[model samples]
Target chain A: MDLQHIRQDFPLLRDNKIVYFDSACQSLRSQSVIDKIVEYYTDYPACGGRSMHKLAARVTEEVDAARATIAKFLNAKKKEEIIFTRNTTEGINLIANSLGFKSGDIVVTSDKEHNSNLIPWQVLAEKLGIKHLIVKSLPDNTFDLAAFETLLKKNKVKLVSIVQTSNLDGVTNPIEQIINVAHQHQALVSIDAAQSAPHEKIDVQKLDADFVVFSGHKMLGPSGTGILYGKQKLLDNLQPFLVGGDTVASSTYTEHEFLPVPEKFEAGLQDYAGIIGLAEAVRYLQKVGLEKIAQQEEELNEYLTTELLKLPKVKILGPEDAKQRGGIVSFYVEKVDVHQIALMLSEQGIMVRSGQHCVHSWFNAHQLKGSVRVSFYFYNTKEEVDRFVRELKKIMNVLL
Target chain B: MFCFIALIVFAILGIFSASHRALAKEAFQCVFRRVTLRACNTGFKEKMQAKILGKLINRSSRVAKFVSHRFELLAWIFFILSIVSTVWVAKGVYDFYVYGNCNGLNSTGFCAFDPKGNNSAVSTISTRPCSLKPPTESDLTLKNVNVSLFPTKNTQAKNKVVLIGCYLCDYTRKAYPLIKKFVTENNVQYTFAHYPTKSASSYLTAYVDCAYQQNKDKFWEWNDKMFASSKEDLFKPEYVQSLLGKEGYDVGKIKACVNSQATKTLVNKQIDQLVGTGVYGTPTLFINGKAFVGPKPYRVYQFGLKPFLFF
Candidate 1:
């Protein structure tokens, strides 16, 4: 696919001439996605599933279509197994709520996990009597499968959740290895694919994950839209965290009975416009091709990372080979302020993210300040990388 | 030379100020001369003071309107801060109404929603009015009643019925459903009064009398129709019966009632007694010389009407 054609679809980049390098945090929207969101509101303005009107029926059908599309994209066993959620954080909380942990029941996760994955488990461990143990990541900041297995040997471990890719280091975790060992020990494994899914293709059936969560915003979709894919039987066992109008089959002043899984999980009005926009986003990505997007991003990251290393006093963290990683390239200039660098780049029309990237646990574990992340996507060109490098070099000199 | 320069500067400033004052004076004087010269010639007093008062207003406005037009951050911050303080003051106004000890020491007037002062603690001290003994059948006390609790025309019928029945007219609340059902059962001519409700037409008066037509239900129909025909002409006793047939009422029954007018007099006397007992508005109910008035909750109505259930 033509990168120019893909770039044209995003008016933000074209008009501002912005080189967006923060797709990890939030992806740029394609015109198709924007039009779909706007069209859904302005043209057909429907209250989904609320009325017997043509608009409501059509909207309800659209929501179902999105569910099916997302489920098929994730390669889940069934669409019913997929629950629409506000975001990945909510999905994690949903699973955490349902796990029904006892005081001695243990859940294993890695240090490289995002706070979305980490905090729910941590809160659960404290609030419930459950024990949450973190498996130390390897020296390269990748998942240490052996260490995870050793922890799993405790036999009290009932659940294992891994960030399929580290937001901090950008090293892809060995989900295939972890899932194998986890299943051997009769533990249900979950993968937080927030970073991995948009850049790479994910087959949950192939990975054998009991549940997987990833956000729409990270995948060039609108915010407040996310998917929680769970195994049907396990999801059936799991209780929903929030209970409300849609979730209940019937309610009275006295007692209430909950409906089946996905509906029970999604309470309140679903972000109908966001979900519609997200489906278009997914279709746009699919059209460009996820494999091709992955390939192009690797090329950009490799060239960018290689150029970044040539600068003095800059130390690159994570895997050196871009092929092993997603599009993210995080690094810190020895004597530079990350925020200032981000600002400087932003002024140059190069959008990069600075901060802990919301992976505070990894930062705390490694004992390092936040670094600047220059993430590339399929639409980003090599020339944009060259300009970014030049800007970075200038910013470093100014910092010194 | 320096003193000379200072003098020159001050002279220039004074000249400019004085000239501006003269120009403004001349402009106003010109307008006043054009519009009010003849009036002043007639010796009108108020217009003369306006010019004098206008100076003070203009001076104060100069200071108050300073930087106000610019909408700068400093002005905005101060204005917003003052507005927030106003809401805070308004929110705290409940302090003036509470007798003995105020129960709002901890009330935030926010969703943190402390209904009884304390966040989680139940109050030992009562937070309501002292309970008074309701009038019994044997002792019907006509204490001052407030009748302003009925629904206005805009309120839904069910809500109006429920509201009037459940609260203010607690003494005669049973009369509402009884009168309403009776009107429907009797096929009494009545329509809910929508607008211009104060003009007391003779037709409306006849309807009220008819509602008291040994049939409790006609009273509701009478009240509904009377308040609805709110024209001053309709209030005249001479044409009141004639106006009754205007809104599709039985003119003959109304006219005959008016010709005798005994029932109308009784209804009027009852209304006067209700008003005398301080039954100022809608839903004022007089039962056995007892006055029940004012809006109350649904539970209050259910409880208040309990004694009159069998009656």
Candidate 2:
């Protein structure tokens, strides 16, 4: 409601001239979380966990506390379920890498994933002699329940990975329905929250996903850090994909043993400052009231998507209903090269992502070139949306 | 005549001074800053569109289930991370653009993506068409040709005049003819002599030793085979003779020669010579010792070669 007050929380908002709309790609960080991270480095910089010293101990405590905070935030069963990762991409890759699927086993995923979700399974399927089946989404970007049911009936599927919200169209999938289908097939589910995590409420327990992966940077946290929330049993069963310092419990030249659960997956010395900042970022969101954040963002989304439709030549993808969508509005204006449009949009100090949004198959299926995607967040406002629409009209007058 | 000469010189100097001042005024700073500006504008527009669309989509729940608090909390955390990732990635990018990776310093610690020194010299290393003073008799001994598509006619003969170093790394076709297909009723026989086996320097050395130095018939035979296909033990010296002998070559003497310190000394000598001329990267062709790096269009090669072939 008080956008001016909200803008004060983010240093990026202080720039009077620029309007940033690509929150699905990455959101602006609040000053409080950023300051907390800076404080950790300047006032109490030390390596987390390998020592008894005050700073080292604090870093370790803060990191674990952050994990606990994230676990609770996700409604995950335990703190141990949250494994810090490079990003959602790495988290999916970890499952695809370590699930130890035997030859002929199937890995089912929806077509709406960012390459982060698609590539790892595709690569792992090829390498491990497993089959990768892509469940098709309807033209509007909603999951085709019949296609998913057909794949589930085959019974060979070992894992099901889906993005909770489509990055391209901002469509919120019937992921809970798919999770139920996967469980019936005795398959584990991995939820990619790269696009969804930043703008929706989630409860991993209710969804019954074996793993839920999301990036901190997409929300307002530090970059190069993400969470891989896995069930403890599955986490224990999985092999370590990256072998390095922190992952090993003990090692000799002949035989080295891996550490248990989260530590085993952590591998090397992490981006400590980033992770510490992310923990503070989590705290900042909690204070803002996640519900208020959602309400504010919805208001912004309602404002932007309507204005986008005013340009007659533009075609918006994803579900037609606002209820089935997040804050993303993906569309392409006729006769404008998506890259050129993106390049032009940049010239006007607006940040939107173009290209297939790293989901190549969706583009291939639609037989369309790339589209322009503008996403929103809590800090965004109606006035900003009006300016953006005016800019679009100007851009259209120039190009279209 | 003196007045005319003074006028021309003054005009030239004035033009140079004016252009220099204009260059000094310079508008755009960096391409990256422009990228950030554009992203901001796009962000603003996206929000406006989402809102208007929301009004239209709320038919049943005109009440609107447009946002989820859970997903929002998730987004906030990820946004924090994106900035950190950008900043974290930026530190190394900055370091790389500066001090670089000299003396084995940890590049990450120094805020570098890798070693800054690695790419720093790349700009300094010229990638332009070289202009030299009139060619001396020593330099213009043979003609140069760049083969864009292979299985070229008289390739065996072409090897002698030009050391054709093929690029298999990029999966450009390496089509060495079958023994049955290569030697026809009237065809040049490509030899398998003096090819390097298993070393990183094999392609360059093979071009030098067999084609340039020896001019053996079996030379291009090995050259095509190397690029056309991949091998398991490409870097091993023992492999050269084993593979080449099967490809049909009488190289008992050549094999012994290649193993000797003399041949190794010669290969080293050639490398030093090329490096001395400041050869930065690979697939470099020294036609009569005049370097042509990367793939050249056949016409360009034809043009450059006509003078030597004619002379």
Candidate 3:
């Protein structure tokens, strides 16, 4: 891939001199995606599925096209399986509320799940009296498949919701194996692919997970757009979490008939502009290829990790191997505050995420304050990493 | 400690910017927590320190290290300095309100509130070319100065205001009306001692002395008319005589008194008495034995008369 050209696609990287290493939180949108969003407001600004005018018909067609494109991006069985959500949190909440878990049902999750994945199950336990069991990771913070399988076997687990890639450490779990094992116990598997879907290729059909959810903003799309891909039969079986104007086919004062699958799940006026922009983002990613993106990220992460390790008292989170940790390198000095490092770096126009990063449960469990997480995307260059390292070293020299 | 400084700095900055207002709000929260004896968990101090150290570290690591170690001490120093400056500014405002000059009464120092030093300006008595030295405020005195010979009013009133002024001096013109109105309203003993700072106005001084000898009450009315008259009109002898006539004074007799050698000698003696008091400027008023050498505000004269007036 032409890395310089890819960087030029993002106006923030092209126009401004900044090293953005917070892609895990939210990736910068490309020019194409921005243009697509602007196109919706300027050209055909109308409500879809409700109006019968030319603009409305055009909007409905464009929205359908975006859904089809996203369906293809996730490799879902069909377009009907893709449900539009505001973000991963909304997607997780929809499933948590719609799955209809009864009392004493068991739900298994991983230890290092993001709050989006972790909190829903916790709420489920509190509300429905379901058992929320956590499968602890290995010492290196890699997912322990054996512990997960044992938990599935011990408890008659109704559902297994886990984060495929942890925002805390950039550690990718073995979802294929976990999903297969969960299926053996007849437990429904839900994968929080918010971190994975942006940096890696995701084939939901190949993985055969019952549900896969991810955010659009983490993949260079506009914010407030996400997707929940489920098996056709499973989505048809679940109740709609939110029901409003567009979710129903025909309604009277007494009773109402719900729309099929995706439409029934999506309620109210949707973020049409964001959905159109997200589809453009998916197309942009496909053009660049996720494999190349992942490759570039790994190289950048390796260089950053090697340089960070040279500093005294620097302790990296997760596996020491950069490849295992993907594009992220979260670390902290022995005595220095992580916020200081992040803020100091930020003053120099280097953006990195600090604090618990919404993985407070994991940080609190480890009795750690949190780490400075630098996540690289394909647009990030080695020179940016060099600048980050030099700044980090200067801070360390003074602080130590 | 840092939040205290941040609160003040950002609050001032907040007046002009919305982003700084948000930071000011955050600093207020941090300060509230600190005052209640809780930890400043808002991280405002660390955030600000990191921002400062971040810039410092790029320039010199040694300086950054020094600052990092002494951050709390530096915050305390800044907090105390801000407080000191705030109090100092408040005092200046108070002084400006009460004394018409930020530095206090009779101070010719630069005052930001009265930038032109208008409150402390005086119509200087042109020094004698043969005199060896210039007169200072220390030389100013009321000793052996017989003020009874000048035009006097309300002689039985307790508080005394003695004004040494000229008819043509602008500073004296600016002060005379305010002083006349204040003394009239407050029922204070007032003495107008005419010292002809301008040589051209020497005849008016003799004319005033003669007018006082003729009719004491009408003499005050003539004095007020003379001060209110234009500078060009005061220069004209006919206009001066016309004002004395308007005040029902015997203009013909006053003119004879103005030309008489006796009136001239008395005027000279009164001038000598003013010189003995080391009077260096016109509109210099001795209020209750205190020498105020400028066109002070009415409140300042009131304050001079009643030191505990505000209380």
Candidate 4:
């Protein structure tokens, strides 16, 4: 890939000098995505799916096109399976609230799941009396498929909700194998692809995950946009999490007929501009190619990991092999505070995420403070990584 | 420890900038946590230190390392210095209020509150070819000066205020009203010995002596009018004669005495007595033997007269 040409598509990268390593938190938007959002606001600023005016018709058409684009991006069987939500958290919350779990129903998650995936199950267990099981990771912080299978065999799990890729360690789970095993147990499988969908191509039909959720902002899309894809049958079976306005087909006093599948799940006034921008983001990602993006990230991660390991007291969080860790290199110094390291890096205009990164359960279980996480995207350059390393070394010299 | 210093610095800076006000609020929270014996979990100190060290590391890693290691120690040193400077400023403000000059009574050092040193300014003694080295506050004395020979009021009163000044000098004009009011209110013995530093105004000193010899109370009234009148008006003989006549003084007889050799001898004797006191400037007052040489604020003269002034 021509990195300079790609960087020109992003206004911040084109205009300023900054090393951005916080893509795991939120990716920067491309100029096309920004233009698409502005177009929605400036050209056809009207209600979608409700009005019959030309502006409304244009909005409805654009929103439908966006849903189709997201469906194509995830390789979903049908466009009807794709539901729009605010973000990954909202998608997971919708599933947790509408999945019809009764008392003693079992739901399983991995130990390293982001709170977006973990906390919904916790609230379910608290309020609905469902059993929430946590499958622990191996010593190297990689997914333990055998242990996950054993848990499935022990419990008649209703749903196996797990992160497709761990945000904490950048380790992709064997989600296909996990779904196959969960199918044998007659349990539905939901995948949290918040960290995976941005870099890797997710074929929902091939994985056969009952539900797949990911955020838009993590893939160069608008911040308040996300996708929740499920089989048409599963989405039809699940009750709507929120019900009002466009969610209904007809309503009279106390009686109402709900809309089908995705419309029923998406309630209230939607973020039309964000949805349009998200489609543009998917188109841009497709043009760039996910495989190339993944390859670029891995190459950058390998160099970063090698340089970081050269320093004393620095410990990478995931597997030692950079290939296994994908684009993320989350680590902690032996005695230094992670915030201090992150803040010092930020002072040098190298933005990285610090603290537990919403994986507080894992960090607390391990009896450790949070680690500094450097998550690379395809736009990042080798020189930026070198600058990050240089500044980190200077910080370590003083801190240690 | 650093939060205490940050709180003071940012709180003062907060007055002029909104951004610093936000930091000041954070510093206050950090300091409150420290005072409550809890760890300062605000991370404000870390944020500030990282910003400082980040700038330093860009230039020199060795210097950054040095500063980081002793950051708390350096904070303590700065904290102590801030406290010392704050106390010094407070003392200056107090001295300026009570003594008119920030450095204390009669000091000529620079005061930020009084940048021009106006409170301590004097119509300086004009240099002459035969004059000795300029007289200082230390050289000012009341000994060997005969105050009994000059105009005296309230002779039995224990407190004495002797003012040796030129009627035409600006500094004396500025101070005379305040001192006259102070002596009258406090019932102190007051003495006025006129010594003209200007040769053009020397003839008026003989007329003042003659007027005092005629009517002592009327002489004081005439003296007040002389200091209050404009310097240009005082140069006209008709204006002086009219002012003396208005004060109910016999202007014709006073003018006659002004030309007499006897009146000149008395004026010369009084100037010699004033000079014997080592007075060197206009508006020099001897309040119970302590000499002050400036147009001081009313409070400073009161402070000089009373030991416990507020009481």
Off by over 4 Å in 1: B1-311
Q: Chain B alone: TM-score in each candidate?
A: 0.29, 0.34, 0.92, 0.88
Off by over 4 Å in 2: B1-311
Candidate 3's residue-wise lDDT over A1-400, tens digit each?
7878888989889855899999999999999999999999999999999999999999999999999999999888799999999999999899999998889988888999888888888887888898899999999999998888888888898888989988998989998999999999999999999999999999998999899999999999899999999999999999999998799999999999999989999999999999999999999999999999999999999999999888879999999999998888999999988999999999888999999999999999999999999999989999999999988988887777
C-alpha root-mean-square deviation, each candidate: 26.9, 27.0, 1.8, 2.6
Candidate 2 chain B lDDT trough over 10 residues, lowest sum: B119-128
DockQ-best of 2 and 4: 4
Which of the two candidates, 1 or 3, achieves a greater lDDT against the reference? Answer: 3
How high a TM-score does candidate 3 get? 0.96
Residue pairs in clash, model 3: none
Tell me how each candidate scores on DockQ against the true complex.
0.01, 0.01, 0.68, 0.66
Arranged by DockQ with the best first, the candidates are 3, 4, 2, 1
Which is better, 1 or 3, measured by TM-score?
3
Weakest lDDT window of 10 consecutive positions for candidate 1 chain A: A391-400
